[model samples]
Target: MTLLAPGSAQVVAGNRRVGMMALRIAGAVVLLVAVAALVGLLWRPFAFWAAFNPTLLGVLRWTLIGLAVGWAFLFMDAWRLGQPLSLQQNQRLAVVGINGVLCLSVAGALIFGAHVVGVQRDFTIAMSSDGAASAAEDGRYNVLLVGGDAGKGRWGLRTDSMTVASIDEETGRTVLISLPRNMTNFPFAEGSVMDKAWPQGYNCGYPDCELNSVNTWVGENRELFKGVEDPGMNATISAVEGITGLKINYWAMVNLEGFKGLVDAVGGVRLNVRQPIPVGLPNEKTFHYIDPGTRTLNGHDTLWFARAREGSDDYSRMARQKCVMNAMLHQVSPKTMLTNFTEIASASSDMVSTNVPSSEFGRFIDLALKARGQKVSTVSLVPPAVDTSDPDIDKIQEMIQKGIDQAEGTAKAAPKKKKPAGQSGMTGGSLGSLSEGYVANQADDLGAAC
Candidate 1:
């Protein structure tokens, strides 16, 4: 998925206006020629000039009048676009505001092109976990949630991890596919088989080619693809798209740096840490330490919390990412965003980039509004005994595929009644009473990742 910058709209709209102007100029030239011919023909007044008609003068008169009217309207449109900035409006703010609206309009048209070419930035985020999107008849939409560290130098942050989220809207079911960065042969673009895609060395030059290195990969590849066709982030999108065998409807590439600002703007977030975890800078010796369990973290600490992986393995960190996601969602109230608009926007200036069209924001808003009162379930892939040692990578993929299929079926049947206490977690969880077959063989397959 590729997200063109908002300024791209100005370029497109400018080109379109230029094209229209050229056409109008051509039309004017044609009219002038006709007028010249008519004047010559009418010069011989003795030869029944106005006998059959108004000597062609009337037609020419009307054409010029119409042209004037059209130009007047075009001028008015330009004036409207150039509406004077308010006295209180800073020049920068006015420029950004006008261009933002224009960019959104252009992005709307870009949606069609994106669909055809498999490029997009905005993704439909299922706010509620009943994952209704996955159950939709339109085929479950699987999205790759990539936290790209594009603005490391500009904003001083790096993408922590990559997680795949699939939603079946029809059945309100969702499954999170978490891929450990170091899980060798985690599937890149080079080979047909997963094993064939693994890097020769795990660290792979400190990130660019490594499975787990976050900072190196984004920065290096972005530079590498600067001149290549469909290069840079699109390569990452393609690799993930191939891995999941699902069209990436939308993608939101969040900048890690802005996350802290966003969190701070939202007045910080509260999380119940299960246990104290050490937090610190990354190094081979004496790393930082962070104690966990029920703590309200500030912006910087929040970054440390989410990015820390010194002591625990990737799986635990995946859970931490989910926790951060949940916290952000819980606090992502319109009031919060509105209050911190400037701060949030400033933080996001270079921190995030996405290909999602601004148009789809409404669709997601509508869906969220509908599911506002429903229950949400969050699941990870690591629980219920995952067989990571299995040599057959296809088996794991197929298992996930099957679970997705069954989950879709279940979501479509009916909303499962809220189970009583002690029934929410995986085991003995109510299958929503819609159908038993959907849950029987599938629950086991879903493992703890459902």
Candidate 2:
């Protein structure tokens, strides 16, 4: 009877009303849950609604907790109703042990799931509490991604990798504008504080005026930017705005060392190595090489892969960094995120510092989801396209505008002329041409180019 109907034994033992009530309630709950699961599977909006709604998340967290506690109680009550005292010793022990194990397993899984949800909630709170900046007048969000290196003996933090991710407000289409650290003679936005300081341009009275050096310069001359909270960052923003001809919305700085922790948290990232990359500094007498091939790299090795310059130049490193960024964006699946939720949240909070407020997280998250289905375009202001030693601001601005137009589908890209049969499409070098591995100075389809 117990096997045929969970509460039937109790019914036969004279608890007829209670057994009937339990059976009805359990059947109704099972039916409701199955229907809901079916609906969630058939209706995509149902899942998205929960993801975008904070209140829904809260309700889910509590619901899981309640269900776990209530289900455990039901299992305990079932064990008691089994009347172990009246049964033989061996049968009684088996029934009690089975009920206890089932109770613990179900309750434990639900409780663990609830804990994970709580951790995600805390992460959301930390990310969203701050207010987001208003969109630019052009209706785009121009976010500066700065890769800060704070290695020992380095004077202050140096922003070696800089890129402006300009996102469309409605469609979420994006254009990545990469700037060479060695770019010189770039102008700041007109009439801005930085422009006032270097009215002519960000040109030190010397032959070498590196763009990356601007961070160190601003750090040394903080008094010049008296009211600025982060002089170096502000100065860099000014330069980037001037170079890209895009208004800045917000900035996010990632500590390169802390970046390793994030990769590790997500079980590392995979990449296809085109060549053998050396790690460690030759000057320090430390040499380690990452053999070429497709494989998953741990935190330490991934960091070096993104920042290595031993057998490669800065341009090659920049291209590699973009590849890593792409891999992280596309490869980190939802299941991986859920499984490593706590570790990822902890690592992300520690590694990243951004001016983007918490209020904008949901909106951005939605946008990111939208972007996942679209192609990502890139334009780098590097050699052959523009002289890094003395960049032409007008040409750079034109290139940026053109890339934006191309990405938005408002303007068709110029057709690429066919290369000679015997020659490589990209420029001939160790890393090949900028467009060889989709490492283009400007490309409509980054993936195709690679």
Candidate 3:
């Protein structure tokens, strides 16, 4: 009776006053919880906001601890009210056993939930402790994604792979604008440090200073950006902003070597392998290939599948990387997140360093969830579209703008690309040849492109 009504046992026995107070408190708690849930259901952003709020999380943790103690006490009180001393020895033993199980199970479940909530708080703090909250820039949030490597000779990390995930603030429509690292002779944003340093463009010479080298250059000349928190990233962002003509809201730097841990954490990602993908560098005798077909790839193989360049060029590899990004976004559902909470949090916190603040954590998560339901689009600055050796800056900006405009319904895409029914020259796990350009690299609907 007490388990169901919280105070019924006491009310029917020797503690009517205590029972009335307990029942009143329980009723109030139920009303409060019901109202909160109803509001959350009606306004989902509020729910996400509440879930990610550190202050609320701390309160929730302590509240659960309190509830566990109080609930166990109530169960024990109910058992005492049953007058177990008056029962036979066997009956008493059975009652005690049943009561103990109820106390433990109910309290244990609440405690565990509280622990999970704490983990989320910790993960958010570690991942989102940089700078101030940024609002949507001209109805969108432009985030720069940099995949880099830190080696012995390099200053910090080389910004080898750069992509801008431009998301619509209202509708969550996203367009991925990818810039090739080899792109040269590009100008920086007007009046920016890079632009001031190299007024004409980032053209030290015919082969000098490719896009990725900007980070290394910034690292070497830290005195130029004396007060900046991260000079390398700031420089790279300036370059990307210059290249894409998009106002970047924030940025995330991902270590490629650490990416496998995230894939493993989510139990790997499922992808349609168009061809056999090499797992090691060409020089290694131990190199093997991930075979063709639709399947889930473990961490090591998934990393190789995305980064492999054994038989492929940089452009083809970029398309494969885009496919990997799309797969991970769609495959890792909220259910997967809940089930593998700790592992994913642990892996992600270690893998990514972002300037996205804690205040906007809920908003970005909500946006990501919204993004999953929409058709993703992409545009890349690779060969045939623009010459990387001496890219036409005006053309590159126009391509990015067109992609974003098409995604926003402000402009029409060139043509509806039919799902590739086995393209003629698909190899190296990408949907098209390097010379022709991969379908996934520049698509109106990335799902069909992949």
Question: Which one is best on lDDT?
Answer: 3
Question: How would the candidate models be sorted by TM-score, starting from the highest?
Answer: 3, 2, 1
What lDDT tens digits, residue by residue, belong to model 3 across residues 1-450?
A: 767777777899858987887788778878988998999999988888888788888888888887788778888988988899999999999999999998899889989988988998888888886588878888999999988774443433577699999999888888988999888888888888888888888988654589988877887677888788878888888888888888889999887777888999999999888888888876888778888999799988998888888778898889988988899988899999989999998988877889998888878888899999888999999987889878888888888888888999899779754545555767577777766788889899888878
Residue 228 error for model 1, in Å? 5.7
Better structure of 1 and 3 per TM-score: 3
In order, how many clashes per candidate? 39, 7, 0
TM-score of 1: 0.50
Question: Once superposed on the true structure, which residue ranges of model 3 sit more than 4 Å away at CA?
Answer: 14-21, 150-156, 205-208, 281-287, 416-424
Relative to the unseen true structure, what is the C-alpha lDDT of residue 96 in candidate 2, on a scale of 0 to 100? 83
Estimate TM-scores for all models: 0.50, 0.80, 0.92
lDDT of 2 by residue, 51-130 (tens): 53456567768977986886676666667776789999999989888878877888899898888777766666555435
In model 3, the clashing pairs are: none
Query: What's every prediction's RMSD, in angstroms?
Result: 18.7, 4.8, 2.9
What is candidate 3's CA lDDT for residue 194?
Answer: 80
Q: TM-score of model 3 relative to the true fold?
A: 0.92
lDDT score for residue 74 of model 3? 85
lDDT of 2: 0.74
Deviating ranges (above 4 Å) for candidate 1? 1-137, 150-159, 169-174, 186-230, 281-293, 368-391, 402-450
Predicted structure with the largest TM-score when compared to the true one: 3
